[model samples]
Target: MSWAVLVISGVLEAVWAAALDRSEGFSRPLPSVVFGIALAGSMGGLAYAMRELPLGTSYAVWVGIGAVLAVAYAMITGAESVSVLKVLFLAMIVGGVVGLKALH
Candidate 1:
């Protein structure tokens, strides 16, 4: 359950990150609202997961998931450029996250 919540929170982190970018410094109402909601949910879930997971492991996993998803989304939407090296790095991040899970 905790892990599930953590994963959801990590996804939310990506959502909030994208929404925040779309918000244009909070000038946009809808995206700003989305950012606020997702930010709250992500933080809440992270806090909850920390209750059961090791602090370092939980934080690293959460950040890893969020960073990978956010960059992937940006690349998909053309907001950021994609490259072979970038994909390789993202895969490495995923590998590290999985390694942490396996160790846990």
Candidate 2:
């Protein structure tokens, strides 16, 4: 349950990050609301997961998942360029996240 929540939170982190970019310094109404909502949910989930998971491991996993997904989404949407090197590095991060999960 905790791991599930953590993953959801990580995905939400990406959601919030993308929304924040579209928020235009938080001046836009809809994107601003999305950002605020996702931010709260992501933080809440992280805090909840930390109750059972080790802080360092949990936080690192959360960040890795979020960063990878955010960049992937941006690339997919043409908001950012995709490259072989970029994908290779993202795969490395994915591998590390999997390794950490295997550890626990």
Candidate 3:
């Protein structure tokens, strides 16, 4: 259950990160509100999951998931360009996340 919560939190982290990009520095109303709420909810879920999880492991996994997802989205959505090197870096993030999950 804690891992599930952490995964959900990771997904929400991606959603909120995308929302933040679309918010245009909070000039946009709807996306800004959604971004704020999603960010808070993501943190809340992380806190709940941390009750039973090791802090270092859980936090690393959570951030890694978010980083990989965000980079993928950026590549797909043209917000950021993709390259072989960048993809390799993202792969490393995935490996780190997986390694943490395996340990946990």
Would you estimate the TM-scores of all the predictions?
0.99, 0.98, 0.95
How high is the CA lDDT of each candidate model? Answer: 0.97, 0.95, 0.91
Q: Which lDDT tens digits does candidate 2 get at residues 23-69?
A: 99999999999999999999999999999999987898899999999
48 Cα displacement, candidate 1 (Å): 0.5
| Candidate with maximal lDDT | 1
Q: Is candidate 1 or candidate 2 better by TM-score?
A: 1
lDDT for each residue of candidate 1 in 22-66, tens digit (9 for 90 to 100): 999999999999999999999999999999999999999999999
lDDT of 1 at 39: 99
For model 2, the local distance difference test gives 0.95
Candidate 3 per-residue lDDT over residues 15-95, each given as its tens digit: 899999999999999999999998998999999999999999889978988888888999999989989999998998899
What overall lDDT, based on C-alpha atoms, would model 3 receive against the true structure? 0.91
Among the numbered candidates, top TM-score falls to 1
Error of 3 at 61 (Å): 0.7
Error at 68, model 1, angstroms: 0.3
Could you tell me the lDDT of residue 95 within candidate 1?
99
